[model samples]
Target: MTKLLFLVADGMGDWPVAELGGRTPLEAAPTPNMDALARRCVAGTARTVPQGMAPGSDVANMSLMGFDPAAHHTGRGPIEAAAQGLELDPDDLVWRLNLVRVAGHGPGDAMLDYSSGHIDTGRSTPLVEDLQAHLGDAVFSFVPGIQYRHLLVQRGGARAPEAALDIRPPHDITGQPQGPDLERFASSPRLAELRRAAARRLEAPANTTQANAIWPWGQGRPLLLPAFRQTFGLRGAVVSAVDLVRGLGRASGMEVAEVPGATGLLDTNYQGKVDAALEFLARGGDFVFLHVEAPDECGHSGVTADKVEAVRRFDERIVGPVVRALQGEDAALLLTCDHFTPLARRTHTPDPVPFLLHHPRLADHALPAFSEAGAAATGLTLERGHDLLPHVLERLRG
Candidate 1:
């Protein structure tokens, strides 16, 4: 039995940075371990985000798991709701709610911070709980998650008139003027009043976090995924800090490992996540999807140095140890990122990201390093991101 490790450094794909000699963060970062692995694996690129779809981590990682997003995607909220193990009715429309800090929202508004400075879960948790207590009756209830990420479910929301409004993701509009999002929220009397009520509570003098507002978007019905063991004949475990990844695992009937201190940020628990994945595999799990969100968070911050350091950490802490631990085992490691969160745009792009599938038994060992440039140089580009998993599975079979 070949143990499979699907390692993902989320949003590590990037465009060339002028400050870093026109090399992407992946190239600028010192990925000695990834470079060494690339020498043995067939280096190539995979388009993780399908064309015409928003390059959210949800969509990209779904593809990485070999599930076509076009078929399985419901929305970001339902996926995260699954992470919480919340049983939802078919008509329940869950919306991803963020504890945002905004100064203005009436006439001229500013999105002071999309994540409310990535508010600590300690502070953000209580605030959301308060909202639930105050506003949650039957139709709307708040669900707390890590950091600023949370959820709001509307009982039978699909039939609500507000469901047709054009909502947007908060991260994509950071440091920008709040536009139709406010008007759309006002269009719904209940949500508009809820927004006002939430502000009074969140902005109270007792509240410390900058989270004075609640931004809700990415609403959809419950998501259903086929069992991984049934679809692929493999018992898989997913290790991730974000609920989005764990939600997918839960929906797919895979084991989801929750590691302590595994914040989806630069300062996350890398060693803890690695131990969880390795332990899962040691105890009869056939595959583990270890995802690191630090690189993606850094990419969203638009700080090139932070992203470079994040990539380096991924290479040193994640890639090096996992490969070394599986030295004597019959294992195959598929290394890749979900999508490109280019610093230039400060958002995800529908561009091809690099990937490498390596097995110790393979004889093809020619590439020197794994990077966006190096992968492109190999001239092997996969059109659909979902195919990358099947390609790696073939290596395990061989």
Candidate 2:
């Protein structure tokens, strides 16, 4: 049986950091196994993010799953809604809600940390329950998610006049004045009051949490996609800690292997993910997508050292072990990031990301290590990232 493994380390592509002596985190990190893999694998670049699209995880990961984002993507919220197995009405609008920390109550106040210091689910979950208790009504309901992420459902909001309002993600506006974005939500009469009340409730003196407000963005109706097996002729599974990726797997009718303690942070259970993936493959599953989110979180924080350490850990913990485990198997391994979360920008960029593909029969490109520059040097560029997977499969069966 031909096995396929697609591994993603979120936000691994990055710009050169001055503090790292003009090397990006991926370049600065000593990933010995990845270096050896690149020297013996097909190296290339892929533009996972389409033109004029916001370089978000929802979009990029969709492309990586061999789905065309421009054709299939509805919005970030609905993808996450799928993760929770929410049965949304066709006209119900689902929004990706975040427990965020803002500087003050006024609209002029600067937006603060997006993840609210990555508040634990234990604390954030109760706060969402409070919102559901206080603000959830016939037209709206709140659903708690992991860490600082959550969801809000607006019944039949797809037909509402405010459905056209474009709410920005809190992470993208960190440290900037939030008046304009706040005004966008204010345009929604019902959501406006909900937002204000939620802020007040979260900021109550006794609350004493980093998250002072509930930020709702990325709203849309539910997403729909063709089954992965039907589309690719391969039964596949997804291993990830975040809802966005799990939601994508669910939407595509693939299995999701949930690993306990699989936080999308630095302390995530890397070994558990590796075990789950190998188990799936051993059980005759033709394909698997293994995703790690810690690097992306560090990218959002703009901490160079943290990002470097995260890349090293991914190499040492996830990639290293997986490669060793599959040494004698007839497996094709593909390693890449979904998009670039440039530390300089403190957000995602549409730049092309490096990819290394290792197949049983393919010759090595002889690159010293897997880096943005080494990939470019290969002179192979995939214009549509969604096509890369199918292309690899075709080559495998050739």
- 10 residues in a row with least lDDT, candidate 2: 200-209
Model 1 lDDT, full chain set: 0.88
TM-score (C-alpha) between model 1 and the true structure: 0.97
Q: After the best TM-score superposition of candidate 1, give how far the Cα of residue 198 lies from its true spot, in angstroms.
A: 1.2
The 10 consecutive residues of candidate 1 with the worst lDDT sum are 360-369
**Candidate 1 local lDDT, 109-152, one digit each (tens):** 77778889988899888888888988898889998988999999
lDDT of 2 by residue, 304-351 (tens): 999999999999998899899999889988999999999998888999
Global Cα RMSD, each model: 1.3, 1.0
lDDT of 1 at 310: 99
Model 2 vs. true fold: TM = 0.98
- Candidate with top lDDT is 2
